[model samples]
Target: MTTTVVGVDGSPDSDLAVEWAAADAARRHRPLHIVHAYLSPFVAAQVAVPTSGGFEPVLRAAAEGTLGAAVARASSVAAGLDITTDMPAGEAPAALLDAARRAALLVVGCGHAAMAGLLPGSVSRAAVHHAACSVAVVK
Candidate 1:
């Protein structure tokens, strides 16, 4: 079955989006897929560091923690809900879009437009404009 996919970034807005996506998945009888993409400065700079140490470990740990928190939040919203998670290492918007390739809905969090600006964050804006399925921008 097509899933309901949500992108998380360890922000309160993302937590809210996780909750919303979980509930929506339950209501629609679809699995919930959570994505947390880690953009590494090392990769962007084309600097290869040993996997044993440096930014790689730190970023992976942080990404795992974020995904774990999101899973707990989602479970709290919908007990026994079928859920899966992906921690893709790349740009947030691209990772989220790829993860939602077969999704029925793509959910993302955005800061308050008034506070951040008149426009939603780049990731959310990209998802809304480019996602193949319906997009939900939860503030």
Candidate 2:
């Protein structure tokens, strides 16, 4: 089935985007896919450690929590909606674009004055330009 894909980063703006995407998906009878991209600090660490110990787990847990919260919020707003969540290990924009490839629509959150200045947030701007499907940026 066609899906409405939303990128969430545990921000209030992303929460708004989730709400908007959920409603649109419910109305259109499409599945709602909530995606969160997590880039572990280890990936950026210049020196490799024998083990990350608790650090990697903590980051993964937080990412899962963010996805869970978004799922809960979406479920509350649109009961009986087909909702799914993803945590891709990469940059937000690349993950969102990958999800968008098979989606009917891609929704992302933007901050106030996102477009008034020189650039919108990098992820939202990149998704707007590179997503395979139509993109909606909720502010």
Candidate 3:
């Protein structure tokens, strides 16, 4: 069965992207996977007190929260849609591309307006160029 994947960074625009993806998935009757990739650098800055655990717990918690919220947002638009969460440790664009392999559609946010031509977030660029499936850039 084809699946839908949405890349979310917890930004308001990404939240909107999630909503769009969910609606599309519901219309297609495909499972939706909401992904939030947290790079080590982002996590390092997010954590002030370092631990041997290397910020796993902190990052994991944030990923869970973000992915969960995205799923909730999806559910709000389409109740009982098949939803899953993927919180991977990697660069955002690369992680999204990996997820795209099995996706029927991939959705991402254009941090800047489409009139800007290119997105403020690099993941949008990667998704446009490298997605193995259909791509949607929500501004």
**How many pairs of residues collide in each model?**
0, 0, 0
**Whole-model Cα lDDT of every candidate shown, in order:** 0.84, 0.82, 0.82
lDDT of 2 by residue, 14-53 (tens): 8999999999999999999999876533353533322466
Per-residue accuracy of model 3 over 1-139 as CA lDDT, tens digit each: 9999999888889999999999999999999998888544444555543644666676678778888889889999999999988877766787889999999899999774222222466778889999999999998
For model 3, what is the error of residue 100's alpha carbon versus the real structure, in angstroms, after optimal superposition?
0.3
Error of 2 at 131 (Å): 0.5
Model 3's C-alpha root-mean-square deviation from the true structure amounts to 4.5
lDDT, residue 49, candidate 1: 44
Instruction: Give the candidate number with the greatest TM-score.
Output: 1
Error at 20, model 2, angstroms? 0.2
> Could you say which candidate leads in lDDT?
1
Clashing pairs in 3: none
TM-score for all models, in order of appearance: 0.87, 0.86, 0.85
